[model samples]
Target: MSDEKESVVGASLISEDRNGVRTLTLHRPQRKNAIDRALWVALRDALDAAGHDPAVRVLVITGAGGAFCSGADIAEPDPTHPVDKMRRLTDVALLLHELPIPTIAKVNGVAVGAGWNLALGCDLVVATPESRFSQIFARRGLSVDLGGSWLLPKLVGLQQAKRLALLTEMIDAEQARALNLVTWVVPESEVDEFVLELAARLVAGPPVALAQTKALLNEGADRTLRDALASEARAQAVNFATADAAEAFAAFAEKRDPEFTGRWSVSGRAVPL
Candidate 1:
C-alpha cells in the first residue's frame, strides 16, 4: 500500500475501497474494538464520506484485528454520558440503518452489546466461523439501549428477541446465521476473501437501481402493502431518469461489458438528516 493507503489503514475505524466496495472497519482490537466517543465520531465521518462518494458502491463494516466490536467501553461508567456523545451514538446507529447504499457487517469475531446491535443495523452481515454475539447489558445491570431492542424484533421475531435481549446469552456464528441475523458464515480465514467477492459483485451491478432498491425496502418495512407499492413506484420512477439505468439496459441489449458511471445522490436522509 502507498503512504496514503497505509495511513488510512491505521484508523481506529477505517473506510477503504476495492473494486468500488468501500469497507469501514473498527480498529480497537487490543480493547476488542470497544466503542468510545472518539471512535463513534470517526465512524460517522467515514460513513458520511462513503455515502456521498460516487465511486463507492457498497459498504462493509468489520473489525480490525481481533473483533467486530466488543460494544461500549465499560472501562468508563455510563455508556453514554454528558448528553452530547450519547445523542451522537444514537443518531449514528440509526443513520447506518437508513443508509441508501448497501451496508454490510462482516462479523469476523465477537460482537457483544452495542457491537451486536451495530451488526444488526447493517442490511446484511457475513460472519467468520469464530464469530459470536451477545447482548450482555442485562448482565451489566442495564437495559438494551442501542438499536438492539428495535432491530432485533424486526429480525428474529418478538420471542427470540426477548430471549437474546433479556437472557443475554452468547450465541455462536452458525446460530446467528440460522436466525437470519447474518447473511453468510465462512471459515475465519475466508471471511475477508468472501466479503470482498460479494462486494465486487455488487459494485459491478447497476448503482442507481441498487440504491433505489434499498430505499424501497427501507420504506416498505413500516408501510402498508398499498403504501409500499406507492413508495416503490415513486422510487422506481426516480431511477428511470438516472444515466446508470439506461446504460444497464443498453449493455444488456448489446451483450457486451458495460462501464458504469456511479453517479447517484447520497441524500442526507441516508445519514438521518
Candidate 2:
C-alpha cells in the first residue's frame, strides 16, 4: 500500500508507482492521448528512471480516457529541423527498447503510427478487445518512424509487416493478437485490472532472471543460436550469484511461495552497464 502517484511532466503524463509496478499514463484525452515532443521526453526519462530504480520491477504504459495514443501530436509547431526531430524520436524508441525492467503496453483504444510502434516497443502488450491498431504511416504520406520498420517485420513477418505498413489497415485487438502484435486482448472494462494483475505476477518473479530473459528474447532474433546459448549461459551464471536464486530453492524445499526482494546487486552494488 505504499503506492504513490506523481506527475512527471505536466498533466499530459501521469506516473503511478504501486507495489513494484510503475504505470505511465498518457493523459491527453482531448487529443486521444496523442504524443507530443514533451510527452516523448517525459516517457523516455520516466523509462530511464524506472530502469535504474530498484523499487521498480515492471513498467506499464497506457492512455487515459479509454483511448491509447492516437499517434504523434501534429498540432504543435516544431522549431527543430526534421532530422533533429526524428533523431529525438529515435532516441526515445531505443531507450524504451533497451530498458532493463519489463515494460507492458495497456492499449485501451486506438494506437496508430508512432503510437503503434510505442506499444510494440514494450516487452508485452495487453489491449482491449476492440482496440484498433495500424501503422497508418503510408496513409499520411510518411514512411514508418519510431522503429516501426524494424519492430513490425520482426513481430508479424516481413510480408505481413509490409501489408500493415503499406495498406495501413486497422486491426482489432484480436487480430493484433493473432498477428503476434498483442499479448492479451481483454475487454475494455477489465484491461486495467488484468494489466495490474499481470504486472504483479511479473514483479513477483526474480528481477535479474526476468531482465536477462527479456534481453535474451530481444536479441535472440538477431543472434546466431550459438551466440544466444552463450548469452543464456552467462545470464544463468549471474542469476546463480543472486540471493533470490537461493531463496527460490529454499522456498521450493519448504513447499512455500518465494518472497522475491528483487535486490540483485553485484558486490552489494548495482550492476554496471
Pick by lDDT: which candidate is best?
2
Off by over 4 Å in 1: 1-6, 9-11, 77-82, 262-273
Q: Provide the clashing-pair count of each candidate structure.
A: 1, 0
Candidate 1 has a TM-score of 0.89
lDDT of 2 at 127: 89
Task: List candidate 2 stretches off by more than 4 Å.
Answer: 264-273
In the range 1-273, model 1's lDDT, one tens digit per residue, is: 211232263358766666677778788879999987778778777777777878777888888787899988878565555477667778778678767688889997899999899888888898887899999999988778668888888889999999998999999998998888988998988878888788777777777778888888777778899999888878776666566666666687899877666455343232210
lDDT of 1: 0.79
Q: What is the C-alpha lDDT of each candidate?
A: 0.79, 0.87
Ten residues in sequence with the least summed lDDT for candidate 2: 264-273
The residue-by-residue lDDT of candidate 2 on 1-273, one tens digit each, is 667666665658899889889999999999999888888778777777887888888999989887899999877776878887887788889989988899999998899999999999998999887799999888878999999999999998999999999899999988899999999888878887899899999988998888888999999999999999999999987887787777787798899999877565445534323
